[model samples]
Target: MLLLATVLLLVEAATAVSPTVRLQYASYEGTALANGVTQWLGLRFAAPPLGNLRFAAPQDPTPEYGVQQADEHGKICLSTAGGPPSNSSDEDCLFLDVYAPSNATRNSKLPVYFFIQGGGFNSNSNPNYNGSGLIMASDYNMIVVNFNYRVGPYGFLASEEVSKGGSINNGLKDQRKASQWVQKYISQFGGDPRHVTMGGASAGAQSVTLHVTAYGGRNDHLFSAVASESQSFPPLRNVSESQFSYNGLAIRAGCASSSDTLACLRNLSATDLQAVNINQPFPGAQQPPLYMYGPTLDYDFISDYTYRAYAQGKFIKVPAIYGDDTNEGTVFAPKNTSSYAESDTFLQNNFPDLTLAQLGKINELYPVEDTPSFPDSSRFWRQVSDVYGEIRYICPGIFVSQQYAKSNIPNWNYRWNVVDPEAAAEGTGVAHTVEVNAIWGPSNVNGNAPASYDPDGVNYPIVPLVQSYWTSFIRSYNPNTYRQRGAPTWEEFSGRNYNRRLMFQTNETEMEGIGRGQQGRCAYLVGIALGLKQ
Candidate 1:
């Protein structure tokens, strides 16, 4: 009789209550992401960025209790003006999403991988990052973390206007405080506080480098490993607003530039604040737009140049995995073409210091002559793939690794040469966000299908191999050196050897050896980057 009554009660409860459960977190909690993975979403790590909180260092999220629900993503820091669709945003948006194994309990202490999303430092979030395969497939229990922070002028506006303490890189401070929060509270969610690996792609990967280098010593005991995919190191160029002595939007909004205080700028609406970074006439300058709306040398967040910071050994010495794809420029290009003419007019306008002879030599060294011809359909794509890849990614990325490697740091490199042959025919090779989609499953890239699936519903088999190597690095700080049953041996980048880079592909998994000088114009560009006479 008792069993029957209990069954009846269970049925009644199932029908009466919502399928999801609500719980309050450290602060500003919510009900989002109650999918297959056990989720704790929108828990604040820092204080709301309203009024007084503006420009100040992040404040700890005061623990609060109440039956709060977290069944979906909360909000993003509203898009920078007329950028993209930014639904909900608030000063209280410094919240993180924690995804753990459904079977994981409070007692299961697992390694943690904190992902910093990439949007050229203007905006991003990890809630959109799917950990289904990385978590379930690895079987080695782990905690996945993603969060959101301020973007645009609200994030990286630096000037004398900050003297009143209402200026600087608030976005970077948000990340720092978020990391601190993870160190403090992740254990409750079954994460090993000490085994954290900070990882990201593009700008986020740059952030990992900056965090370790600029904000070193702060969390020496916290993060042990880092993986930076397409991470651009500092000394980045082409930030229109940043180059000027004052904030670009401030002047545009009729604020007096003569004033050296952030009072007027801080009072603007978040919408208006974001307008400063909107549709920034796509970076035509020498440098890639890694942080057009990102952290600057705020006395606290960034004290010096990021490259200098790393070179001085001021960064946390953590094992790192950093590399980029073969063609990352397709992410952004204006009618792609594989060639760029170094006109005398352009040289005079952009690099006035260079003589005609110098400019010619520069072009010759970083040659754009006699290149591969692309089909009419793929012409534009090839240009974007070549020029942009050289300037924006390949050169900078390799420079970063070589710089760190010179310092004897434990750094592993890979070139994601995997391209979908069909996609290549469509003019998009192993494109910019291809690896990202493959690693984390799918994103809203093509609309109908998930990010990883091709037209024929083919799933890339390389996904597991890449994920396994990544997770292994996250777990033991060692990328899987184990040769597959019939695969070739993966090698480390030793100076004794010229150039050895692993190619993570779809079917043909292998590593190739080549000459660093002959492979590409990386060494020549490095000289230009270091300011040595060509």
Candidate 2:
């Protein structure tokens, strides 16, 4: 059957013409790889959100006159001037890329896997979602979709003046458009839109959960399953509360007096908007100012706070797979704090409405770990990392899974314990995002360098298992059914094992069931989150 499917796909690839249209698109043969992989790169699913359309919801593209060359990648969205992936930062960067088996045919009906790139919605680009590795790793068993969306201020700047119709979470709206695009056009690429699953890590993972909660749980039939690596129900501000950032941004952009702040800001150059640095790479030194641009509770797209929506059982009913790193907080944990008081001050200052009582509870939950690897780690820093991990990431994942498990939601959960040996030497085990290269395969292009680096080769013994489980879920919305490489049987999450998680470690450590160790520590966070919603 596989051989027959291969012949059919090769024949179709040889004679393919684009039948799909967001508005009359045409297909072109993409780069044929040495390993026989093929791609249709830089495909535009929506019209460029430039000028008058800036900050507005995405609109479908205007039909083209002829087949657009999809051999090259699209420009990445505007990012910090020196940040990675590309120097081709522009407002007209809303594009997506598709990858498939060399033999995949339009009639193949292969499962479509839509992946969103994560960078805290501040940095990173579509280039970060290198799908070639996934194809190479999965042997082209599925079609992969990767896309670029507005990031930072260009995507998430919010204010009441702009909130009238400018849309608070335009970045997320762009995400929705990308998913919708797949449902409509993926068939031409040998993809089954009905079998689509969405996946993300870090900010991308947050986006998936947001989709799960968008508009009180409307599925929109975009994705039937979701794989969230490092998913979090991040603390976000309501539209009214976001007025502080909006007021400051408008003033900084010299649009303070404009009756239509959105219009005035839209007319400004992308350079002008990018000039105001709203986010920090870490929590100290030059990291003055609190907060960064993120999704806002507009009472429309994101009607309620995320945790509140989940606790009330108001999210999409799809089965979900989510997990966090064993040392997830180490990467984002605040640095340079000298005393416990500094940590307390920073937390109270950064997070809005954080009460002293909560702060006290947090202090009690985590103490300084002064192990040789974590030598002299401040009580403040450790405590902050603990709270951040719990409230920001850990609890959200477990609590959501448990909620679903109780209702028989069949959500799968895990924790990543395998860190690169290099990071392990520093005591920061498996920091956030180390698993991405294992799954997507890092981009081969490195600015005038050869595609020489291969993380999979270094990660050989374990890479296949992780990649298989992910693709398995994408294909069948279940991982156990496609268990590969003698990988262990991953159990569906249930109330029977409430806080239990599949511990994903190396061969020596072994994948096994590990009790959620922080249930008691996390309860305080869950309570605080619930209280805020009420």
Candidate 3:
């Protein structure tokens, strides 16, 4: 009892420093911005999921006093080989950062804009996803939150045995745990627990949609609104279906020989775990396996297919904004395909469950030619690109929006058409991740636009325009009510306006409605996605 009491006392003594606001049992120090924004970096929301906690669900951090020096960015979860660049990766990396308005006293109550970074559910870093620039761009009274979550294998490993032994979706659960923590602690930062708005791009956007549809719309009141950019809801694998991936990874890591492989995995060093699992392509495989370290239907956090949940009205009903980029296929489109035979082989290999008849229909709908496709003569490759862009991005947005709109929920849709001339690949129009440049505005850290431009960088007019809509949306669930003069009144999506979308472009020098281009593309792709069930 003496030793236990001494340890507790030491912990309390280590973190007893005071700040403007105080957590339930701890205190934090943050950097004050020139504009009076108080910034906190690298705050722990949960205990480090290291050692035995590696693959386990996140546990709450010890709530004791210690001077939490939230000064520098924390380490990110180890990344996969193809993931975004990371400064460093470590098991002890579950942390969050925040930016609060200067006027945010402990008594102040401001709406919160929480963002999740996207890297195909494979990689993302808290430092790269700073919310300071977002605050600066919006210049609103809203508070912003940024954080790191596990990705790839350490975060998502699955099998029946593994599931029975513990649980899956550790990475996703990490986000939920962090949200729960926010509900408990954000008030200290002058953020209202009742008015949290969640948003993200790509995989991060996908996360937002999943949260909306999680447990059939079970609302913990953690969020009041959602915004997704280029969100995709691919079919998730069941534990039975995920076993092959788990076994293969275990065998490769030499954990299969152990009687308790899951335990063996937990015993292995984080580096060894990643060395064997990270970036190891399937042997002679076409597409990566569904259960290979991505979100799966664990039946815990996610009850069913996200689309099916939307279709069945099984998600939290909240106002939302969804958007995609035009020419999304150019960047992710398959390449080096010479003919239909090769394309057929690729699909058959990637989607083994797809029958030849269905594949043939898909091919018929997306016929290819030797026609030139921008910067190259490989026009035939558009077959795959067309389908990929629609299936993974465009259609998914329309699919979810249609379902939610039917329920009379206010939904907004958009297609970002602006492309950076020098940055784009030959023939590829506005590819993925372009809208992010517009949303966060230009940053010296990761600037994509050419140096020398107006306040919004080369993104100019479009950047400022987009920031207005986003900040407005964050402030009042609607982006159209308030904005700069001459800005197009953003339209709300509904069944009547199902086909229309806000088209953001540079040439038009203004946003416009896209009522006809690529008409029926999303409808056809939704059909294909639904047909997959049968």
Candidate 4:
């Protein structure tokens, strides 16, 4: 009888250990996402940012209820009403998702990629970012992560009211906290903490730039590499000015007075507080007004401007890949309405470095002969869009590349110039978000289709190539050796004189000149965009 009972107990233990069931994670008061080879979603990283924690840095996720189901994503970060209502948001919005090869429970440590979503700075959530394309293209198992940071005033408000009490740049603080969380727990989900790569596009890309160049101290040795798509660097763009200088914004948000700013603001309802600063108009408010609440170059987090920091070689030396899509500015910028002479005037006045001869060469290459080429009353809009994208995104990206190249760091650059005329007629082309679907695969979200842009219908030919290169870089800190083995030999950046950019022009792939003289032309045009160097 003793032997029989022992045998029965052994059988029960064996049954409990099924290959299909990996582990269960609890976050958000007991919510769970079953971990295994297949897939899991909505794993909490921090506690809800509600009530007393509304405007403070996010706290580590704590269990509140019994084992909660994490099979589906949680509600998104709260967005402004009337726009797309975010589903995976809440005051407790810090969470991440996982996707493995259905049979990923093997003991080997796999490469991980933590994604940051783009919505200028004000909108977009991580739950909307999927990982199919990235996983399917390489053998490296992906731990695609997404988390919510405070948005608008509730998260970014920096008033003497709150600053006096030591609360500033709560949104950025949340990002740092999320990276810390990944370092502590990602391995439990089958990811290699030392082989992680953090990446994103647009605002997300900017976040990646910040992480590598400014917030490196917060990563705690979690990520091995970094990649950014369509990252921007505007004139006078400094982390310090953006974060701590809330003098104007504080008054606009009615939190100017330090005496009781935090107490008074904290007492108000979430919605009411969000409205306090709505009347204040910010520059570049048409898109991503969230920049109003971004991090400043303060001692608590960042110490200087990102570009200046990079130039001084104070950033992390991890291998990085940065690129921009074709016609990127068309979607983000407003219509053109200035004349060629006006554009010329703008450039000449701002970028004194460029002469009339050089400016004329730039216009000739990009073309501004026929004003009607653009429908707007003035062709200046087209000039601004093209020039702005080059100077703001492309030039800055390349500037970083040049610095990396000079430092002997592995840096790869690409320009996605493939423009679907059909997409462009509707006002969207290889816009900012176009490459996302190809990188992360198709998401189930509704508005995936921008009003003027089609989904491209078919899979992008270079999706695998790009994804493989990225994963390889994440795993080995070099894009040279991809998982699938065979891939294009991507070259490193060598400056304008010997420029070469991996140009993805169609369903077919190829590499070509780095626009030869176009890079210089773009730099000159940037003078106009920034009202500097013209």
Candidate 5:
């Protein structure tokens, strides 16, 4: 009788820790954590994009047999730079992870938060995100989902032949496939597809905005709301304009002499192809664009430039939260710049279509000025940073927010200003991606929070505060519904609100308005957005 009792206890513990969910494809057994969160990691949503499928849209995963253990993460997609080393990355990396309350059942129908990882559209950093913290922050009320997508040349390669083969913007298509997978299988995991909120940071944010205007604003009910942090709007070049890049890559890959370059590229070994997949300067440009390959003007999927799409009211009418960091350009700006001529050259290279007169006006608007906040950088560096910030990130976000307001869409805007002491000391105050730890909580940042985030435990409160607002927005669409106590109500960014935005800071969160000078600068840039190809 004693031996039988011990056996029964062990079986019960195994059943509790390994929870299984049956999907149309197969049964997946996920691990249940002590914090009441259950996670199914490295589950394949689409088939491996190999051989002919390279640079093509993702397809549904093949049916699997028996139960698969989803305890480990899948290999990340290959990247040109700043990603996992080549040995750790692969071409067959189209898996996703789902996190939900341990007690959640099929009938629970909880809200879902589908997050996209950002890495400048050239790398996949999905491994950095852990959804368990987000589930715990929601008090086990909602589910969180994140996934991996193809990046670099494997995803964004483009040319006339590639376009003819229907392979443009494969990276964006991978994101769509992930979202569609959620809509199809999330209900089986106790999530409501109707209440899904899509959120992303940086390039992921740009992907959200692009989906908002995808196929000329066709709403497929993929997501009901959006949360975009530090949205980026780089210039959208046409397929013909990208042919040079394709030619260059072909030459480097030893396929230059092939009669059918596209077929040759598709047949090359993944290792050989990856060797030549790297960023290169555009034609006649001194420096390369921050991102080598991005979404192109594929008349079918992308349709038009993002600015024109928003201007013409070609976007889904969804409640959204749009925001950016205080110094968005400091990280992307040219550091060696020291004079107005260098700044002008940088702008000209970035926007080669801009006329000299327009460049002069831009320089006049942002003259060389001392920024005490950045004492280490030269005055010209500050000027170029300011210009790049407005043109690339800040102004684009505000333009989208303004369009939403004009259409009476409920939306909230913000400027993240949380200071990191080390970054401040390095003269990059509140640089890009600093708010990620705050949103995901210190516990989820690879097991421990950086000293900059929880210094002496003084800045710990802001983590919960930031998580509360985000999870609240995920659950109820309105951030104030479940905001932390003493946290001020976040107002909508409407015309009557004077284009006000919440300033997210440590112990000083408040609302502020867009100044007239900044507004004028944005207006000038928006007027010439087409010429700049943005």
Candidate 6:
């Protein structure tokens, strides 16, 4: 009798430490952290994209036979950055992680935050994001989800044959599949499928925008709200235009001689193929953009340029929050540019189709000036950085918010200018993705929090304030309801005198407006958005 009691007690303790949930495919046992957050890491949401399934849309996961331990994260997807494959990275990477309050049950019906990580569509950087802090900050009122999707040529490869045999935009399709899985299975994890707020940063933010405007504004009822930071609108090349990339990769991979190149490419081992998965020069461009593999216009998944689609109001009418850091382009802009001619050359390299007249007009709009407002290593560097930031990150954010306001959709815009002491000292003031530490508390960030958000650091105070606003929006489409005390009310973007934005700073977060000069600059860019293929 004593032995039986001890065995029962051990089983009970094990069950308590590892909570299990059953879905259609399998039952997963999650780890219970000390902070009262239960996380199920690396739960497969779709089958591995391998063999003939390479470059194809994600398919449902095959059913499992028994309870599987979901303690460790899945391997990251192979990247086009070209490094040796390890146990941590593989082609069979299509898994997601979920974080929820340990005390919550299916009836909790908590709100959900489905976050996507950004890596310029070349690498999977989802490991950097941890949902524990966000869940704790929400006071256990919400669940957070983050996942890995295919990247690089494995995800975005396109060609005429690929269009006929497989689908384009496999990366975007992977995101959609993950969202659908949330809708079908989140309830089992104590989340409300109807209240999901999809969000991302950089390339991930661009993915959010694409999903909003996907299928020419067809709403799949996947998400009810959006939160995009530094949303990007790169040129959307047609599938035919991507044949250059396809042909180059195929030639390098020894598949050019095969009559069935697609099949030949698929038959190559992951390691052998990854050896040659590199970015090549795009057609008509001497140098490729930082991201060579990206969303292409396939007519089925993406019907038009994102800018044009938004102009036609071809986007889901959901409440949203759109924002960008002050110096979004410092990291991506060339530093050696010293003259107008060099800057013009830089522009041509990125947008090779730009006519000489357009280049001249752009130079006039952003003339070289040595002023405190545009401080950088050099005058021309600052000039080109401003131009790059506006065209690539800032203007797209403003344009999207303005379009949302024009359509009477409830949306808020903000500009992040909190000076990180380290970054400021390095002259990359409030550069791209610096706000991520503040958004996810220091405790939850993957590593030691940056000096900016350290306890005694410069930008530490705004952590809770930012967290509350985000959580409030996730819980109830409006950020103002549960905002931190004394935080200013974030006014909705309006089509009035000017589209106002909330400026986030160290201790002073306030509302501001889109100045007339910026408005004019963005107007010109939007006017030629189609010409730019954006």
**Which is the leading candidate under lDDT?**
6
A best-first ranking of the candidates according to their TM-score comes to: 6, 5, 3, 2, 1, 4
Which candidate wins on TM-score? Answer: 6
- Point out the higher-scoring one by TM-score: 3 or 4: 3
- Residue-wise C-alpha lDDT for candidate 5, range 1-534, written one tens digit per residue: 999999886555444333787888878989988989988988998999998899788998999999999988777888875443355578898989898888776667889999888888888754547888788888989998888888888888889988887589999999999999999989777799999999998889999999999999999999999999888888888899988889988999888899988889999888788778888887756676677787788887899999999999999999999988888888877877888888887876676677889989998889785454355667777688888888888899998999999999999998988877776676666777667778987767675454756635656677888889999999999999999999988899997885799988889998888889889999999999988788
TM-score of each: 0.81, 0.88, 0.89, 0.79, 0.93, 0.94
Candidate 3 C-alpha lDDT tens digits along 1-534: 999999876664344222444676557788877865678888888898877787788998878576777788788877665333246667787888888876565445677888887776667732445566656655646788878888877677778767877668888888888788788988777778888889888878888988887876799899999989888655576677768777877897898889998888888877677667654333344565322457878776888877777889998888899989876666655667767777666554444456678777777778775334655537767677676677677888877777778999998889887766654556666777577766776562265533322364455678777877887788778887545568887777887776567888753534344545355666665666644421
Question: What's the number of clashes in each of the models?
Answer: 15, 0, 5, 33, 0, 0
In candidate 1, what are the lDDT values of residues 344-412, reduced to their tens digit? 233323222344565565556544443334465334345434545554456666666665577666777
Which 10-residue window in model 5 sums to the lowest lDDT?
A: 9-18
Candidate lDDT values, in order = 0.60, 0.71, 0.72, 0.59, 0.84, 0.86
* Each candidate: RMSD: 6.6, 4.9, 5.8, 5.9, 4.8, 4.4
Q: Which candidate, 5 or 6, would have the higher TM-score against the true structure?
A: 6
Clashing pairs in 3: 15-66, 15-67, 216-314, 217-315, 217-316
The sequence of per-residue lDDT tens digits that candidate 4 reaches over residues 1-534 is 999999876664433222233233353221222433344566666777766676676777765455455566656565433133334445455656666554443344667887777654455544445554466666645656666666555556555445665466676667777777777765555566777788887777877777776653354575777888888653332333344334554564576666665565566655565454442323333223323444445554566566666767877777888888866666644564466665655443323344567667767766755323444335565665566567557776776777788777778887876565666665545776466655554442334633222345444445555666677776676777763345556777764423566676545555666665656675555434433311
Off by over 4 Å in 2: 1-29, 80-86, 125-128, 277-291, 369-380, 442-459, 509-517, 531-534
Point out the worst 10-residue segment of candidate 2 by lDDT.
Answer: 444-453
What TM-score does structure 4 among the candidates reach? 0.79
Write one digit per residue (lDDT tens) for candidate 2, span 1-534.
999999977776665334232335544446656675677777887788888788788898876665566777788887643333345767788888888776666677888789888877865433635566676656677888888888777788787776775777889999999998888878777788888889887888999988988888877889888999888565677777667666777788788889877788888877777776365422222333233667887777887887778878888888789888776766666656656677776665556456778777777676655323255464455556666766777778887788788678878988877656656655565666566665664453233111221444344455667778888887778887675767777788886766667777666424455444588777777888855441
Instruction: Sort every candidate by lDDT, greatest first.
Output: 6, 5, 3, 2, 1, 4
- What TM-score does structure 6 among the candidates reach? 0.94
Please tell me which model should have the higher TM-score, number 1 or number 5.
5
The C-alpha stretches of model 6 lying farther than 4 A from their native spots are 1-18, 371-376
